[model samples]
Target: MIQMAKQYGRQSPTTPFLMVRCSAPATWCFFSGTNNYVWESFNNPTDTILPTQVMGLGGMLFSRLTQNNYSRGRFELHFSNEDVKLYLVSRPDDHYYRFEMFNATNASESASYQLVFNESAYINIVKRNGETVPLPLISWRQSTFAPNSNNYYRATLDFDGVFRQYAYPRMRSLIDGDDQSWSVVRYLPDNICNAFPDQYGGSGACGFNSYCRAKGGTPSCECPPGYTLMDPNNKFGGCKLEFPQGCGVLDDELKDPMESYDLANISGLNWPYGNYEVL
Candidate 1:
């Protein structure tokens, strides 16, 4: 709701127009003029989940984590509603990354990949056991941003998740290929900051803080191993634990309050007799 870009900067232009407005109702948005990224997901929108996206829903439905400002938090992930199977949650705690979704009508021939939007966006999409494999069709070009001029672009995914992409130039700038110079063929995957960090760690295996986005690509983080950081502002809370344990309470003769103990003959215990008789 607020997508504007009409020659606002000027870059090739001859065909590029994108404009969208939403009010929220199972919100879902995705726009990528090939490198200008935008992916918004609020509620529901089956099929078309990008950005290190993972989907496997047959029944059980429970994937929590809403209150960063969305409201609250604590649902984590529950499945068992009937038990279907949909994993792909990795972070400092909740870990998962199982996949299953590549049926294709009945299964004869149908696999696809190549999901790159802009700024080096990424999401190669590759499945093996479950099938689905054959992705490579993202390629685009035509934005020297100056020549014949006639370009307009848009990509949005904002309900709070934040995802954007924009471009403009509808009445100025044109040089090569003329006709108002503005060409964008299709060869995406190089923009989203230079996507590659396990493709945002969707299934690439969460590492830093956890983030894998698609509108193009470029979103990385991962930190879990004894924790560190204190607070860069709050990356989930910046992690903590680095080794600090001591709540006290342990002195009953070294505290052993056993409930049961009997390991055979014990007399100053020094057991481990195998071959030794040198007296």
Candidate 2:
């Protein structure tokens, strides 16, 4: 694909964009800029997709380790195939969300389904019988920044394992000198914490000993009192106890672990699972 894109770029250096379609299994189709600005594959998705991209029956989206690392993370988004539904799975193979929980799945006996974000950014799961249904909790709010921004919409399976949609304005091509400007319209998963249900054992919701919250329309993680970051570099790695698990000696016991520890009660904080024990 890169070679083809490069050849096309050399032939039409001034062209704004080129859409390439192929029959190979590795890539179905892609859009490449005449220059070097845009390169998006509708099939080779890592963790993101633009509106109108079709996630085929066997297609998958794998999250990244960190924001910077592109290697496969512990989370994945794929068609369940079992019930023709879309599911997001994390490490330990726990299912977090059924991304496509449409009523159509249960109504049809189709063995497979296709997922796609319409040009207007509406998520739909298409059954083999040609029935289309909208994903649950979809956002219908119109985009104020780019009223007709269907041409530039994005949906990503975020590092936090939340699937979200975003809109971008149609702006002038970097080299084409054509006028085109657009911005984000609307996104999904109204509440970040809501995406992480408590039924999945909280294995992929967030790091252990950490709290998950939504701030500025995004998921944020933080450690509570009496604990510090386990890996200061990776917040998702979880937190470590500031105090030792048990005193090893009389001298260790003499030094009060609770001297610096203060009880903290956080209200409205969301956990991947319930804090109360089943007992």
Best by TM-score, which number? 2
In model 2, the clashing pairs are 169-182, 169-183, 170-180, 170-181, 171-180, 171-181, 172-180
CA lDDT scores, all candidates in order:
0.32, 0.60
Q: After superposing candidate 2 on the true structure, give the runs of residues whose Cα lies further than 4 Å from its correct spot.
A: 1-40, 82-94, 99-112, 137-151, 172-184, 248-261, 270-279
The Cα RMSD in angstroms, rounded to one decimal, for candidate 2 relative to the true structure is: 8.8
On residues 121-196, what C-alpha lDDT tens digit does candidate 1 reach at each position?
A: 2223333334333223322222232222245443322221222233445565345433443233232233322322
Model 1 residue 178 CA deviation (Å) reads: 62
Which residue ranges in model 1 land beyond 4 Å of their true spot? 1-19, 22-62, 66-84, 88-108, 111-249, 259-279
Clashes of each: 43, 7
After best superposition, candidate 1 residue 147: deviation in angstroms? 54
